[model samples]
Target: MQSMTGFGRAEHADDGLIARVEIATVNRKQADIHFSLPRELTALEADLRKLVLRFISRGRANISIHLERVSGCDDSFSVDPDRARALETAFNKISDLIGRPVALEASDFIKAPGVLTFSNSVWDVNEAEKAIHPALETSLKNLVQMRKAEGADLKTDFLKRLNTLETYSSVIGKATSNVVERQRELLHNRLREAEIEIDLNDERLLKEIALFADRCDISEETTRLASHINRFREYLDSSEPVGRSLDFLCQEINREFNTIGSKANDAGIGQSVVGAKTELEKIREQVQNIE
Candidate 1:
């Protein structure tokens, strides 16, 4: 088992370049990856996405990559000579029109829009991959480790809740066993108190009691609930992604519990069903975080 929430970061410096990668994830029904990469690395988005998907099957993940050149690297900013010349000519014309010298400092032209252009570092795809892949691998390893640790904790909680559910299911089954007989006895006593003398073996009374028994019996629901619980436990032991599967199982469990609650008729059995459903609800919430 693994959780869908974790964070990891790694940095690597090589050949006058420093690369940093950070990855964060939260629980989601499907894998959704968003990346923040420098323009030079944008073309590698597909490969990066594939790498992330290989590690994470379900989550909303945010990946960010930052790259910086070492101090000794060549300058990345340059002035556009043509634009600077045009600006200078325009300034001289303005000065002639004003009939006075319009003094402009180098700082003015340097700061002008389009005068100074930043040159993006040329990147070799192979070199960039070599530098970034290791950092990404390290980050993913840490993320998985954290997720596994959290999954262990979640597993403990889920097991406790499952035990509670099982206990309540057992109680409900026992309470339901004699509920029909008890109801029939109570009905007979009420009829005698009301002075309604009917044959104890009347065909109508027997049919009504039989119908009541059928309506109140929750054996089928309890059996299915047990099956679902066992399947849920098996899924917990699985190594593959089981979040969706466990979620579906939780729905099935809740459905069976709801049927039992509605049909059990006896107060004690109803209460037990409620308790079991409560535990199952908690398990469902935890399953949402599993992957």
Candidate 2:
């Protein structure tokens, strides 16, 4: 399983353009793709989104692409005549208003916005897309590699907690033994102390105690919890994204843990269940970020 949160960046330096692609991801219940690109590249958003989704099956992803001409790609430069004229007119008007003769220098024209321009060699969007693929692939590969490392660590932590849960399940089972008999003894002693003569040999008494014990039994819950754990481990072995499904499985495990805690009334069993539940809750917290 991979983590839903990660980052990847790729740069394609080809021809006269330096195209940079950066991707940031965060934990989310569903797949979401957002992009920041120049207006010219906006048309490619759908294709980029599809490519990103292929690498990331679950997460909210932020993708940013920036393109700029590098020195070797196209070095041709020119002045925008209209913009230069506009800037010169503004400077001359300002000088006249200030009652002074001012020289409109080359620096002034160069400093003005839109005064300088470059003519890029016409290029197809498809070629740029191909060049970006390698960089994009590298970035995603790095992100997934990190998530795999993290997932391995998460698996280790889960195994330790699962063992704890199993140990507590056993304790609950052991603590349940003779519990109804003990409750019967207590009730009999209390009645005798109160000077109330109640027949302990009645089948009704046995039936009542047995019914109470059955109500408190957590065996079914424990078995289901075990099954869920096994299934979860199996998911970790697969290459596919499992964040959403694992989240549901974690909830099921927590529900089972809660059920065991509520039904097991023996103090030892209850305490153990509480501890196990705490561990499960921690595991569940991590599940939200799992992929």
Candidate 3:
């Protein structure tokens, strides 16, 4: 099991270049990857996306990659001669405006913006991949680790809630154990109070009671609800991703509870059905974060 929310970062330095990769993920129904890469590395986006998919099957992942030369290293830059000429012309105009000749210093030109540009590193795709792949893989591994850790915690909470659900189901079962008999007694008392003096064993009276018992019966619903709960417990221990499956089971469980609530016709069973539904709602909320 794994969670949909996690963060990871890694940096790799080689051949005077440092590659830094950061990944953040959040809950999403599908795998959605967004990347922030240097222009030189744009060509590698497809390959990088494939790697991300290998680690994450469902979530919105934001990946950022930065490549920079080591401090005090200047080998990755080239002077733009045309830009330098433009700067020189601008400097000459500035000197004239001041009515004095301004000295042209190498340091001044080197410090000027747009005079130097990063080299065309994309010319060698293999080299760029070599520098980035290690950092990217390490960051993804870290992200998976964090996700699994949180998933363990979520599993614990799910088990606790499942226990609560079972408790409510038990209460409903007990409350409805003799519901038919109770209803039959209530019907007889009502008939007596109305002074109808009808035959207790009349075919019409027995038929009406039988119909009422069938309508108020929730045995099928309770049985199905228990089955759904057991299926959910099995999913919690599954090795594969079960978020979607668990979500579907939650819906089924809620449906059973709804049926039970409506047919119960007793206050105690109705309250138990409500409690079970409440627990199922919470489980559904947490299931969204699972992967």
Candidate 4:
């Protein structure tokens, strides 16, 4: 099992370029990949998405890539000679028209638009990709490790709650054993209180009691609930993605518990049903984070 929540980051430096990658993931019903990359590296998005998909089958994954030029590179600063010369000529003309030696500062020309520019070092796409791929691989590995650790914790929690559900189910089964006899006694007491005379061995009363017992029988539900629980445990031991499967099993379990609660009319059975339902709900919540 693996969880859908985790974070990882990695950095690599090659030649005069540095590459950093960060990966984050959160639970989702389907697989999704979002990337934040520099314009120069936009073409790598498809490859990055494919890499993430290799590790995750379902989740919302966010990947970010950052690249920077290291110091002491061959890049240099240069002045646009044409723009600078034009500015200098204009300044000379202005000084001549004023008939005074107007001072012109080199800083003024440097500040002029387009006068000075840095010559960025040419980047080879293949080299940049080579530098980024290793960092991306490391990040993904770390992410999977974190997700697996979290999954182990979630599995432990689920097992504990499953035990709780089993305990409650056992209590309900015991309480339901004499449900028919108890219902019959309640009917007799009601008749006595109403001062009505009816034969305890009347055929009509016996028939009614038999029908009531059939209506309230929960043995089938209990049997099905036990099967569902066993299937759920089997899924937990599976190595493939089991979130959707576990979610479906939770619904089945809940349905059986609901049937048992409605059919078993004893107060003790009702309380046990409530406990089982509570534990089942918690298990469902935990299952949502599994992949």
Task: Estimate, for each residue in 213-241, the C-alpha lDDT of model 4 and write its tens digit.
Answer: 89888888889888988988888788789
Can you list the residue pairs that collide in candidate 2? 16-73
lDDT of 3 by residue, 93-130 (tens): 99999999998888877788768766633335666687
For every model shown, what is its TM-score relative to the native structure? 0.85, 0.81, 0.84, 0.82
Clashes of each: 0, 1, 0, 0
List the global CA lDDT of all models. 0.85, 0.78, 0.87, 0.86
- Let me know the TM-score candidate 4 reaches against the reference structure: 0.82
lDDT of 2 by residue, 1-291 (tens): 788878888787776567778888888888888987755556777877777777888888887777667765556777889998888888889999999988988888767866875555334587567666666767778777777888788878877877887787777777777566778898788879999887998777778777888888777887898899889888877788887777798889878877877776667777877887888888888888887
**Candidate 4 clash pair list:** none
Best by lDDT: 3
* Of 2 and 4, the candidate ranking higher by TM-score: 4
How many clashes (backbone atoms < 3 Å, residues ≥3 apart in a chain or on different chains) does model 4 have? 0
Candidate 1: 10-residue stretch with minimal lDDT: 117-126
lDDT of 1 by residue, 139-254 (tens): 99889999989988988888888889889988888888789889888888988999998887888778888999999888788889889888988888877888999999999999
* Best-performing candidate as measured by TM-score: 1
Q: Which whole-number lDDT from 0 to 100 does residue 142 have in model 4?
A: 97
Off by over 4 Å in 3: 75-124
Model 4: CA > 4 A from native: 77-123
